[model samples]
Target: MVRCSSLLVALCLVDTVTPWAPHAAQRWARHSARSANPQDVETARSADIVAVAESFGVDVNSRNKACCPFHDERTPSFTLNPDKGLYKCFGCGAGGDVIKLYRELANATFAEAVEALVKEDRPKTRRVAEVKEVDASERIQLKQANAVAQEVYAEALRHQTSGGARQYLRKRGINPKTAAAFGLGFARPGTARSLTKDMDKSAFVAAGVLYQDGRARFGSKVTFPIRDACGDTLGFGSRALKIRKDEAKYVNSPASAVFSKGSCLFGLDVAKDAIHATDEALLVEGYFDVLALHDAGCANAVGVLGVGVTPRQLETAARFSPSRRVVLALDADAAGDAAVRRLCDDVLPTLADESGVDVVVMRWPDGAKDAADFVAGRREQGETDAAIASAVRDLCAAATAWNDVDVCDIPINEADAASSSSSAPPDDPPPDDSQDELRKKIDELQKQLAELSAQVASS
Candidate 1:
């Protein structure tokens, strides 16, 4: 019995250290918890200890002593060692690596904390004049500033006076519960500048919440909180409730230390679990599309923050979707088609070669503008929930793989127009073809074919 117990203990230790142990899945929940991936764990552990501490607002002086966050203490007891990538507090007897420091300070699960650290957009070593690089300490402060701003915006939306924002959401078919779940908010005029009045102006400015001149980036817009998979509020994506003649209809917070348009995916915080569960990711272009798909029960949807999906965004998606399947459900307009063509011609091929992931593009329902519209149309036609899911699945199933999709094909709009014209009835009746007319038409076709063959042979 003693020998058997010792052997069991040894086996458990080995299992804990193994890379992606098979039992990891059974050990954690999909959404709230993460399976321990050894590579990710090592990456998180290797981060700078002092920098990680500083990210949580821990001030370490020359001696690396700070007040303990875990226990009440008047004197400094928490100590961080950068060289060893570890931290300890004598007062509370707490100790661990940088990952533990982050997990505690961020109030995150071990997996969530690791994900956050690994996914952090670490600034490059080389300095670029145009883009400001934020150190660990400053980055935390910026994130804190964003958190406060998001709260302010959310509170503004909940206010009785913010009916216009609520009305806009209603028009979009977004219920109150869904809006609240997504952290949708509003930034009233003058509220932006006022909200930063009591906060750190420089931090807010660096966070892209306030302009350098102290003006707010969003005003009278329905704000969407853009967060990472770990639920850290990075920035805001806002749509104007009432578009000003000179102002754009939509605006995103400017690139900052915590937020980059190319790297962030809208609704990722909410959709990552579904992506992991399905082992697939549904990529869309608009924020509304993400919301719509999630509401329709297709929760694996995420939206690109910019005009098109970037490699950084794809990399992040691939991390969650272990099966490495991505379905493109971008808009069905001419611009959307052009973007798809560009991806097929340039981006998807290279990504396929490197990652060996299967990517496909979805075919839109007739006359639908985007995913949101497509879902809305189905609902309007009285489709049941399961029926809608089936329809969506069918469309995905019918999509062609990226490599097989022909980029040389004309745009959807052009093809639609051509089809419409060819099938429509002619205004005048066709005249009978004479023998000479038939022969002449055949001869012209033969001449064109011969010319194409000659050019092909020459080339």
Candidate 2:
């Protein structure tokens, strides 16, 4: 009977028609043809082959002994056949090719897994059949631009007279050591044109240091140089020193060949070691919040420029600590509540299900807007280091246990009188007051009679 019902349901589903059904059928035919050709499959497979074993921090060439993701096993049962780009776990019987491994690891569908692999495997540059060699003079010019920008930014910071840039760092809880380690600096007003005189002004304009209206805008703001893991400066993030209420607070370099906002966390390069050592990360919404956390001796903190959390950021955070546990400290507004809900519902579940990362939501105190504000308010009150640390830890603990169902289960906005009356259990006795009173009087005599009957029965 169950089988018959299932068949009926399937037939019903097939009978429901859509206008795009014909187009979907055509696309499926093309996809089938692509999958059927063994030669094409082999070429595409080889060209984009990914060794899941190696990708998961394992040595592909070594014996099949590594830490398993399925269970807590010290001995490696996960075997990688790099020759075929396939992996199997003998212990847990988990097996798959590259795409399957990603699906299993990320808890995503086949299409999502394919998309993840495509993003990971795409080459940085397009392939050229014949590569042109750069001459010595051309190489020297490229090197010169790189070297001069570093020196100019460094010099600008060292010369404290350069428009209160050093003072800004001091005010933001960034000590001298941290600032120098991150190569934090101010861009001199005329320096962009001077440094890139030989190069095109378009490059500086693209880097967000100068305006395209033929004016250098560095002197108008304090700049922080953003770098890659290799310590090469990719772009600049500028905070307006003084601005009208209508002006933007922070401006970043536009997307260029080098700097991709989606792939960069503001302070991850500096904070990576600390994050790995602690096995945790505190994700704040601003650069100063990260700085404050580090200064407060909680060094495992990093902030993304935007509110949107991307897959690349998650992957990068996971690379730092495979068991990534993040505490999100966003603002305390309607937007913040919505952001937290989205993270709990969508982002964290996907990460937890696939990558085994744990995520927690930290709520700021009422009227304390964001991380920076919280830290500043505590500092003003001369709060002890221990007190501050304990507060943050408590927030993290609360966030770790946050559940959407629990939040939505209780109606918070309704009146107490209405809610209490509505939720109270029904009375067991009938509504007739005379019957209820008569029953109560009768119950006393019945209890006495029952006691007497028990004695008589015993006799």
Q: Can you give the TM-score per candidate against the true fold?
A: 0.64, 0.59
For model 1, residues 1-459, the per-residue Cα lDDT tens digits are 454455455545644553333222322233223355779888887888887777766778889889876544458988988888888776534566787677656645556666777886332322236444346576678778888888889889989999988988888878787787788888887676657667878888888888888877887888898887667788899999877799999889887767778878888878878887888888889888888887787888888965577765775676577677888877877678778777765566545643455788886775677888888888899997578777887887788776556444534654474565674554643454664575575566556656656766898
lDDT by residue (tens digit), candidate 2, 3-56: 445545554554564434554455445444433234433343442333544564
Residue 90, model 1, lDDT: 66
Worst 10 residues of 2 by lDDT: 404-413
Q: Candidate 2 — which pairs collide?
A: 66-76, 106-354
Angstrom error at residue 292, model 1: 0.9
Q: What TM-score does prediction 2 earn?
A: 0.59
lDDT of each: 0.73, 0.60
C-alpha RMSD values across all candidates = 17.2, 14.3
Q: Which ten residues in a row have the lowest lDDT in candidate 1?
A: 23-32
Q: How many residue pairs clash in each candidate?
A: 0, 2
lDDT of 1 at 97: 76
